[model samples]
Structures are given as structure tokens and as C-alpha cells.
Target: MPEVLVQYQAEIWQAIGETFIMVGVSILAAILIGLPAGTVLFLCRKGQAFENQVVFSVMNLFINVIRSFPFLLLVVFLIPFTRVLIGTAIGTAAATVPLSIIAIAHYSRLVEQALLDVPKGVMEAAISMGASLKELIFKFLYVEARSGLVLGLTTSIISFISYSTIMGVVGGGGIGDFAIRYGYQQFKTDLMVYMIVIMIILVQFIQFSGTTVSRWIDKR
Candidate 1:
């Protein structure tokens, strides 16, 4: 194993770098897009601050329809769009497009749910105190739901990592692609085991950091 690691150290590091690129870009994009989307969804829901039946229904339908598609199918389905946007649908950059789209929707729903968990009375009290919509959302809703939001982001990050692996199927470069080419295709069990171990360690670290951060912020 030590020999093998020494032999493939450069390739392994490169693959790891590619994985981080895909996951990092996807997660960052998701947070920027999803936070607003989820907040809008929450505010526009029936009986909520900005409730509008038509807008809520349309947005809800759109999100659910996209979410209902299998990730692999979504990847294939979005190929043309990805190609048009990124010039090709088969590299880390191309892969990032679909991953970010899916992550946005996924994280949006998560954010909406997290915000929903905030007590209704909290918002009402804020309103009674002459809080504007912006103030209410930023100060009360988001502050109260910060822990849940962090955990949701954590889960989304982990999920995107898994999805990045799947990107390997479509020629998207990452550790998964490397494993497929060297580990599975070449029947190198040791390589496969290495891939699994690396993924497990990465996931464990993410989970631990997320938990610690959530607990630290959770005043309640």
C-alpha cells in the first residue's frame, strides 16, 4: 500500500484537487442562489409575510419538478444547456454547472425548511416592534435559524461531494473518475480501497466541523 501510494501520489493529489474544485464551486454557488430562493419561498408561502398564491404556486411547482428528476437524468437532460453555457459538457467546469443547479434547488428547499422551523411568534413580535421585512428576515428569522442553516449547508456540501463522484460517469474529472479509470477499470482493488478511505475521511471531517459549528452558534 505504501508503495502504491508513493507511485500514485501525484495523480491522487490531482484527483483530490479536481474534486475540491467541483464541490467548492457548487457549494458556493448554491449558497448564493439558494439563500435568496429559499427565503423567497418561505416569505411567499400562504399566511407568510409576502404571501402571494400565484407566485408561491409557480415557484413551488418549478422547484418540485426539478427536484423530482433523478440527478443522473438531470445531468443528461441539462447537457445541451451546459454545453451552451460552458462550451462543453464533460469537464470539471461543465460538471460544475449541473451540480450547482441541483445544489441550488436542494439547498433552497433546505433553507426554506430551516426558516420555517423558526417560531411564528418570533416574526410576529418583530413585526409588532416595527421591524421591516428586511430587518425581520435578517435579524430574527435568519439569526434564529442560523444553526439549522449551517447544518443544511453542511448536508448540502456532503451531498455535492457525492454528486461530484457521479460526475465521473460523464467524464467529469475527479477522484471518482480516477478511481473508475484505475481502480474499477483496471481491477485494482487497492486503488478502490484508497478512494473509499479518502472519501470517508473527508466526509467525517466535514460532519465533525459542521456539528461543532452548529453547536457553537446555537444559543438555544
Candidate 2:
């Protein structure tokens, strides 16, 4: 490590941890809630099982509205709700509230698009074989769309990292916040560049891993 890095190793590690916490929670929310929500959106579309225009329209509009907000404004707007839920609108934990909400909205839309890419023939065949909704999802739709799903998650995770960088507005410290404070404000230009390089490496690794896994699992 360079002299500058050696000087701030501990702070750098702590920032990394904070970034992980914020991004990890967002990932969990995306998987647990967003995945199902997207599935519901797909199912409720016209001519699919349990199709209901009202439900579809409501959900579609809600997701669109959430996604439409500029992220910084969204974070500021959600301060009151974040404080209510986390008892403070500042820090790593508090930052997770908005991160998770946006993650769900972001990933849910990608998931719906992924499922939509699944051939219509797959759905018809599943129905012909008397597959239950659960069976249709797990056995057919998900399997066929697994690669797209993985790619979507990969894209979402990258966006989460980008969003986490702005958490400093709420005192939510992460690598980005660390860079802005100790590196930029302190006039440590080299340190800021190093942090940016680290983020680039992290994103590259994630993209590579996600693509490899997607390819490995893809049957089509």
C-alpha cells in the first residue's frame, strides 16, 4: 500500500463496512420483497393467471412514481419517514431505509422486464401441464429467466453503490462520504482518487461474478 493509504487504512476499512451494510440491506430487500412484487406485476398483466387490471395499474403506477424521484430528493423527502422507522434520519442504519425502498422499486421493475422476456410459449405450456402458480413460477418462469434476473440484480447492486455514496447528506458515512470529507475537503486529492479506484475495482468484480454465474446457470 502507498503511504497515503497506510495513513488512512482504518478509516478506509470502516467506510467499506458502512458501504457493505447499506448495500447489503438493499440487496436483501430487493430479493425478498422486490422479487415477489415483480412476479405479482407479471402475473397480473393482461391474459396471465390472476390478471387484474386494477392491481396491475396500481402497482405499475406506484413503482413508476417511486422510480421517477431524483435519488437525492427522495432521500431528503424520506427523512421524516426514515426518522420514524429508524428513530433517526442519519447514520448507516437510517440510510438503509431509503436505499431499500429504492432497491425494491428498481429491482422490481427489472424483474418484471426479465419475466416479460420469457417466451409466451413457456407460460402456455405450463398451463397445459396443469402447473400451479407456484410451480409455474419456480419451475418455468424463474428457470427460464434466471440469467436475466441475475443480470438485473447485478445492475441493481451497482446502482445501490452509486446511491450509497450520497448518504453523507444524512451523516451516513461510507467510502464516498469518507472521500468527500477526509479526501476532498481535506485537500487529499490522491486519497479521493484512490477511493474512486477502489470503487471501480469493486464494481468490476461484481459485474464479472454476476455475469459468470448468470452464464453458468443459464440453460438457454
Residues 29-130 of candidate 1 have per-residue lDDT tens digits of 888998888999999999997899888888788889888989999999999999999999888889998899888889999999999999999989998999
Cα lDDT tens digits for candidate 2, 90-183: 8999999999999999999999999999999999999999999999999999999999999999999999999999999998899999999999
The TM-scores, one per candidate, come to 0.97, 0.98
The TM-score, computed over Cα atoms with residue i paired to residue i, of candidate 2 is 0.98
Residue pairs clashing, model 1: none
Which candidate should be chosen as best, given lDDT against the real structure? 2
RMSD of 2: 0.7
Candidate 1 lDDT (Cα, 0 to 1): 0.90
TM-score of 1: 0.97
The runs of at least 3 residues in candidate 2 whose Cα sits more than 4 Å from the true structure, single-residue gaps closed, are none
